[model samples]
Target: MDFQTDKASLKIIRNKKLEYELPFLWIRDNCSCNDCRIQETKEKRFMLNSIPADLKPKKISINEDALNVIWPDEHETIIRFQDLELLKKSRKPEKILWTNDFIPNNYDWSDFLTDDCVAIDAFSEFIAKGAICISNSPCILNSLEDLAPRLGPIREVLFERIHNVSVDGHIYNIAHTSLEVPPHNDFASYSWPPSVQALHMLENECDGGKSMIVDGYKVLSDLKNDHPEFFKILTTFSVPFREFDEENETFANEPIIRLNSSNEIIGLRYSNQLMQMIDPSKKNLDTFYKAYHELCKRVNDKKYKSTFRLEAGNILLVSAHRVLHGREEFKPSGKRHLQDAYYELDNIENNLVLYKELRGN
Candidate 1:
């Protein structure tokens, strides 16, 4: 068999398996990047035991000279026909691509929140539109207990949601002491970017603890406009992060920000305390500091800043990568209570699909 990229499709002779033409988008959507696979506890494959066997595709097809084959599952698999003999064996493998751009414009939180849990249609609307809001209503925080059932298993919604996040030894402590959390992208340290972050405000009487959010995309765009050289250097360099535990005693490190093959901003690492300095030999410290400071300055800008007090019952859902969140220092006294959950965009989308299917919307 011959392989060529100039043609739109390729003819794949069916040996013992079925075949069909699949779109390039399908292949890109199913890319098997390391981040797409599970890496915890020495396992690389996702727990597919729950996936029904009938859901698996028995065969695939590609139009003559086609670059890829669209799978029955609506994903695509790229094929290199140079070794057609190898194609005679089992089924063709498909790759999965992870992306943050798939976040929906209209998310219905009612689908995930019930009477037992705090279901704020108003806040849900805000999340759908990717906006932020503060609330002190009684209906919000009271709904947490019902959340587990309404949202199903949390793992279903947040693919990379960590099970062991310590909340100062409390099951649901809305407010923690004034330990300044470094300004960083949520889940940036994780190999797989967090899809969505939900922070519910149960109580907030403390002062100077305003929640801050900055549009990271806009910040990067500004940097590119004003300092192309600096932008290039930052993008080229990798930053590091660490999370330590005395009881569990574990630490991890990775770049603060990452770019995909298309040069798109795909990840962000903004934890100042967790981050280690960049290698000075590869890039000058002075220049890097100037770029870093400039970016931080933009992040702190009043116009770019969206500050809100997470009053009782107000749940804030935000895109982890696009938005950077932090809190101002507050008094050590008084209690701040909230229940929080992390979810991946995939799980959220899946829930949205189920919601739509159930409501027939």
Candidate 2:
């Protein structure tokens, strides 16, 4: 195998047949040497603009650990080939779809509290599948606050960082009332929705209050596969979601389905209760409703959703961006309290990387 570069690109040839090219500017900008980047902080000291517009490599050589590039300005920089190879494998694969046959897995809270590795594993499972249950946690207020640092800092929503989930009649939110909350993602109307949501069930002293969680990605996958026209309507049209408490009014317009440039499902915003009017002038009303009803039908189907009651001291964690969560109605006979909090995906992934680095995983 041989490596070669010129003004425009670098070429790597292997077995005399296979080859790859790396752009010279990209390689120069990514210099990992101490003079280009701080060794400890990993922050850049050299900017890409510092390279001349017509700059090219003076010479290229390979050492045991790095590829050395001598630039036209006589500046020597080194970049490890391993880093480039690692990037090839870093793109995330499409998420796996879960059917109703999905069995919920619970990680023991006691084990997590004792072992850092165990805690990391639990967070990782939640990140991958979008849902996880922490069983047999200490039944106490603010139990979620203890686990907040395990992944990242908890965020405060309209209700605050840790809101009590019960029917006291003080709050007008549907979640606080003993009503059958539909399968929906929380805070769909926000311009930037919270990526992580967690619920710690402290008490389940009533009858018939079960929790439901559906994989939004799975539902979208099914719709896109089965009804392409309906999927097209859902993805292309934006709808309104509004929330108003006597003191504040929040509203945002977003499509029920979010997609990437390649038209693959990337995010979802779904909340039937909070969704407001979609004016008929925007599209064909009859057609839109037909497609909308079909999507809702699939979401509500048992074959696409997972429902189970949470026991006291059980915590349900979800990546709210991809999973729809709801609750069943219960009698107001006794206390049914839960504490919920939200976090950003950045923080969760941030700590995930930190833990892997610390554990040398």
TM-score of every candidate:
0.57, 0.91
- Candidate topping lDDT: 2
Off by over 4 Å in 1: 1-176, 179-182, 249-253, 279-287, 357-361
- Give candidate 2 regions above 4 Å deviation: 3-7, 62-66, 91-94, 283-288
Error of 1 at 36 (Å): 26
lDDT of 1 by residue, 211-302 (tens): 66666666676678899877776775666554444433223355445678988765555656556555667556677677778877776666
lDDT (C-alpha) at residue 143 in model 2? 82
lDDT of 2 by residue, 190-300 (tens): 967888888899999999889999998988888888989888888778889987787767788988888899988878888988999888788666766888999889888
TM-score of 2: 0.91
Checking candidate 2 for backbone clashes, the offending pairs are: none
> Cα deviation in Å at residue 28, candidate 2?
1.0
| Backbone clash count, each prediction separately | 38, 0
